[model samples]
Target: MTSTIRPSSVFLVSGGAKGITRECVIRIAQRHQCKFILLGRSAIVESEPDWAKDCFEESGLKKHIMEHLLSQGEKPTPMCVQKVFKKISSSREINNTLSRIKQAGGRAEYVSVDVTDALAVKEKVAPAVKRLGSITGVIHGAGNLADKLIEKKTEQDFETVYAAKVKGLENTLSYVDLNYLEYLVLFSSTAGFYGNIGQTDYAIANEILNKSAHLVKQKYPDCHVVAINWGPWESGMVSPELKKAFQERNIGIIPMEVGAQMLVNELDAANHTTAQVVVASPATPPARELDSKLRTYRIHRQLKLEDNPFFMDHVIAGYPVLPATCAMSWIINTCENLYPGYRLFSCTNFKVLKGIIFNEDLADEYILDLQEDSKNNDFNEITFSAKIWHKNLAKKNQYNFSGEFKLLREISPAPTYDFAKTPDGNKINENREVLIPNWEDNNFYQNGVGMLFHGLSFQGVKRFLTFGKERFTAECCWQGIEAKQQGQFPVQWFNPYAVDLSTHPLGIWLQHFYQESALPAQLDKYEQFARIPCNKDFYVSGKIKSKTDINLIVDFVIHDLEGKVFVRLFGSKFVRWFY
Candidate 1:
């Protein structure tokens, strides 16, 4: 709260050229008629405070009086300088700021210097002592008050406010010369004492400066160091809404000058005893006297709730885990034909969850779901048949598994679509099998149309449908001419054909699509898994038809604990079963 720093007799006012700090500087300087050094971010070499001009412009101003007094003119008071600054602030255009100052008869000058740099302050600011003949006080009024919460605050945001205030204060204290510096006035705020709601971090940073106020005062005995806890004032920082709001509270608005004057008034007493003072338009109530419910900053500390052991247990065990799994299931199985809210794989959530049996210590809140799903009710027992492998399961050593199949307790609804190929007029070709040439373009387009146009039938894959148009398509059968998928009765037109599918991608891509995502394990007896077209078009079976006839990949999803998924599949026209 030290308003000014005195060197010899002149007082160095930090941020003395603008804002509430300006008035504080002028009032103290003119009152004592002591020379002053006003500081700003920019340089006075380019401009000087308008008071310097008005002093030389008007007839009765200070400079005019000094020169003409002996010869006989009257002397104007310090009020002559105040008019210049007021007009500049109200000027409609920035270009007229200096002109308005001149019209009102004053001068404005600034010396280039970054106030935050201590070395710069010691050089540019301390030298003002000799230039002005003496320095009396310094007001550390240059600071900021931005609003941001801790959670949202970033590194740059916190640095901006800290640099202007904390750095500015550190710069000022470096020059507390007893013979020259008499007062140290810092424009602190209530935020420093009681952390602001949205500015907890900012307030904590300011407290670092506040806590050292006494030490600063003790170090500089001649310098009166005052810490002002400023409240909402009608300044650039105050919103229009706040101005109107505070007006209704019957509290008086301090003209920036009054707030400045408060600092100046306290500067005179920068002694060993009086180190801190709060400057606010409306005094706050005693600490801890306010209602706890009304306090927003103490939310974490003021939490109140009844002890619910079950709720606590749920939190520890992760209550929303099941819900998250259910969401994923719904997204992956959107086309499942179930009731509005009920889904097919939805029950799978309970199945896997049964694996994680909570101890007896599991909370009642979690136990509430026991009756919800009868299958999940008995958490003590949840197991499925392990996968068994044969000595030579597949042509490859790595790919194979055997599972004891479990029959469904009840059959679900029938499928939504039917396929009929034998009739006279049907979309399906009368031939049970069809094969395109190994280099046929028609084969690629028909199979890749879904992949290239709307997108892949699986996980939205964009494949080489055109293959650079350099004859991208082809057809190759898995078996000999006589080994094509055969029908129950020989119909001349009802023969399945083969298209060259060699270039097709054979890989795994996790996708959400209805159908058997993979060929039935790997055919152990045959070197490769075979996809044979059945006589019945759309009958549900382990057999998959992937040629020009059905236009499908080895797509299937086994409804078992062990899952094998695939899409964009390829196989042969003739495949045999291992009976």
Candidate 2:
């Protein structure tokens, strides 16, 4: 359907005071003398202060202001810096934008309201509607980014990122009369379409917008509901470092003028067709090939124990630490992305050099470095040494884990064997007088071990067979919740959650012998013979090889009810955390 905007049409733009929205308003106003209502969170000042004006025109004003704050024994935080700049800078920007719109023969007004607050949005829009007549079109451009890995995101971080686009749209949609609304445009991002490495929350938020646009279009067939999944644009949002990173991946940044023009073009082509469109520059090959010997990728993450409540179940000694299996899954997933059509077969010489402890307030950044074997000649088979290091802003990078991993094009079938028929050499009967009837009744795991939290189906231990402190065996059932949660297309062999459950006997032994919980610090060798299905009961057996003041070395074998050994971990060391 062809559509045209009248000179007297009322247009509402969220996040309109600055950035892309401001640019769009200026461009649209130049075309027609429309009535525009701009909504933003920042308040407009009556007049720009002298210092603010000087700061806007002068080059060294920001540095001088920061230095002055420091001299007064005040910390110059992000909030403080924004406060100083907004006092003059933001007001000047809004005023200049409004002045330009008026000069182009358009009438514009700004309203200060948090778009996430439904009542506040309703209150602001009602007055604008009464004054400018019924709202005809809307451009929902409000969004925020909290770029953190899934493991590092907090509940607050998720809420903050989600509220900008998802909740903001919900609040505005509640006030708009969609029956007569001419157009509804949403500014989405590529992160939602192709998942980014460290933008879990942001991707979720934008994907919601894209889906909502389609649903809204179905209801209001005449109204143009379009969600544009845009790539990186040269704006305040794109940092220099981020631009360089995107460049390295052969992704081009859209120019501001080009992006603004694309928005107008999409609106003009209002056919009520194509609910979502991706506007991105053509990809190009990297300027230089990465070194075959070494390659490294860095990611910043803010891990919070409370973000994913299930993670709290894997606690050790009153502290939450990431399980080794989870770390391995991350590494394997990364490799799969780098090399398509290949999967990780097994990891030899696997080791957890250090435990990653979750901090309540601060998030940890990590660097994954890969070293390729120059001697190997096989093109299909790749052998590489992988190391994961936690970046310490103040101190040196702390080593977390290191191992040798192998990727294969395809895996062989599982060999047949029956583990249930094997004789139990150190079995402790459940009915025995000395052994505890219920595994949870044992004080050793309940009181001493912090990692074994209740309600965590994947890490639940059904029964424990203790043959003194030197050896132990446990039975664990796969609850099948992990597969449902992960939603993996083709099920993977050696489920990471299953691997974690199978290794619980080691933690139990550590508490039994030392009266203190320990973390898996090092694994000298781990070999996976075959893939284990998630819908099966498994047995874990561990034998303590040696013990020291701060470390315990153990060998573990994980097998199914059919007596088939799926994986074997030898010379795995558990280290005590004194802190």
Candidate 3:
């Protein structure tokens, strides 16, 4: 449907004296000789105002006024400064805007009306409609921002912010005749669309406007109702500190002229029946930025027992479960895809929330959501709260695993560590008394760690060394089977198979100490100090830090023949299994 308004149409705009509303009025007036009734809370003054020429020109005036207020021994708080600015400059601003509209060949008038008050809005709007004829368009741009972290916001702050947008739109709707209205535009914000850090109240208020617009459109089909979710504009509303914050996040501020032009184009086209439309520039440096607040990346894989029949060999309690190491590998693979040059430096708070069980009848879909955290650029750290959920499961508990991962530049310096040594200042030799001699020659396929031949290709331990009651050391070799199986060499810092094999000593330590089989339940801190070679021998050493009835806390490291550490698992944990 064509949603066009004539030049002689009557338009009523709220918060119309300054900022975005003023810019819209100026743009519309330049194209159409419409009658505009500008509504604002500040009373109009008859004085010629020099500051009215430019919105930012009042900075010097505000500084002078603040100095005078201070010289009079008064505290110049934000409220005090605003009250003084409004008293001295509000009238000139209103008068100047009206003059500009008239010069653009549009008839204009200003009225001081509290739009949140239904009776006041009706009282003012009724007279304007009677004087200027039926209202053709209404722009509800009135909004107040009480930006505070949700925890710090009080009841009064929420009410104040809500009054201008939510309450003001309600009052305006009550007075305006929707049947005669050709356009009803609500200026919403991106805060409501995607949310911002300290804009809880503002987000709620604008979201209400967006939903209300949809409801209004159902009743007034002919009248175009739209809520434009706008980003921060380069205006007085955005402070320098706020601008810098947005810049750091790669969020671009909408230019004043560009925003004004968008408003005109939307109203002129009149083809928008969707009720909600977003008007904002794409995020700068889009590579690292996410389109949504919570980014979910997904992968679907059918667990076929026939295709990889060896997976059935790693069953626990008769149920086939994906290995924890493979899960970590999948997450690392995703991170590598999202951030090409960055590598996983450390993973902490890793927990097996629930075990994923496979079914032959249905294919399983896995979901990975990486929530962006407050970044610390000084450390070159990009932290994310990562989760892997089983999407095909009908059970209420869908999360298979959850953890926090940090990615750093591959060029970052490796961590330095002093491995435990002997009193003679030489590396500790494998104690022959406790060592398992000819471990590789034993029937590992029948009597070994739970991993079978196919699993062993990735998780086979070659030798055991320095075995003791609470501490042990062992050697594992990466066969590069992952490269052969997948037909491509993995460039990840830590080989998943090699890393998993290194943890086998922890299971041996658990069997020797607790006399039971155990599985890795949680990993607190896993750090990769350097990249491991594809097909090379690596040493793993671990020591028990503490032991509970069911859990053992251990620290382990994976290093090369030269004793250069490749990966370290600190504050690691294993849970003893009964079945």
Q: Which candidate achieves the best TM-score against the true structure?
A: 3
Summarize candidate 3's per-residue lDDT along 1-579 as a digit string, tens digits.
566767679888999988888998889998877888889998765553543334455777677667877888998887898887777677877877998999988888788999988888888777777777777888999988788989999999999899999999888777777877888999999888877778889999999999998998998888888999998899947889888878765578889998999988888773676899987643322135333344545555444555544355357666666667667876776775676446688899898876666655233556777776635545555667878876443544377788988887534555554554332211233443233432334233345543232254455566555666667666677666534343222435556666766777666555545557667789999888777666677777887899888877889887765677788898877777775
Clashing pairs in 2: 152-302, 152-303, 315-451, 418-562, 418-563, 419-562, 419-563
Model 3, position 374: C-alpha lDDT score = 39
Global CA lDDT computed for model 3:
0.73
Candidate 1's residue-wise lDDT over 248-338, tens digit each?
A: 4433567776765665566554343666666654322222211212111100011011221111211212331111122122222221111
Q: Is candidate 1 or candidate 2 better by TM-score?
A: 2
Local distance difference test scores for all models = 0.38, 0.71, 0.73
Ordered list by TM-score, greatest first: 3, 2, 1
Better of 2 and 3 by lDDT: 3
Off by over 4 Å in 3: 47-84, 281-359, 363-579
Reference-based lDDT, residue 14, model 2: 89
Q: Is candidate 1 or candidate 3 better by lDDT?
A: 3
- Candidate 3 residue 152 C-alpha distance from true site, Å: 1.6
Query: How many steric clashes between backbone atoms does each model show?
Result: 79, 7, 1
Model 1: runs farther than 4 Å from truth?
A: 1-8, 42-109, 176-180, 244-252, 269-272, 281-579
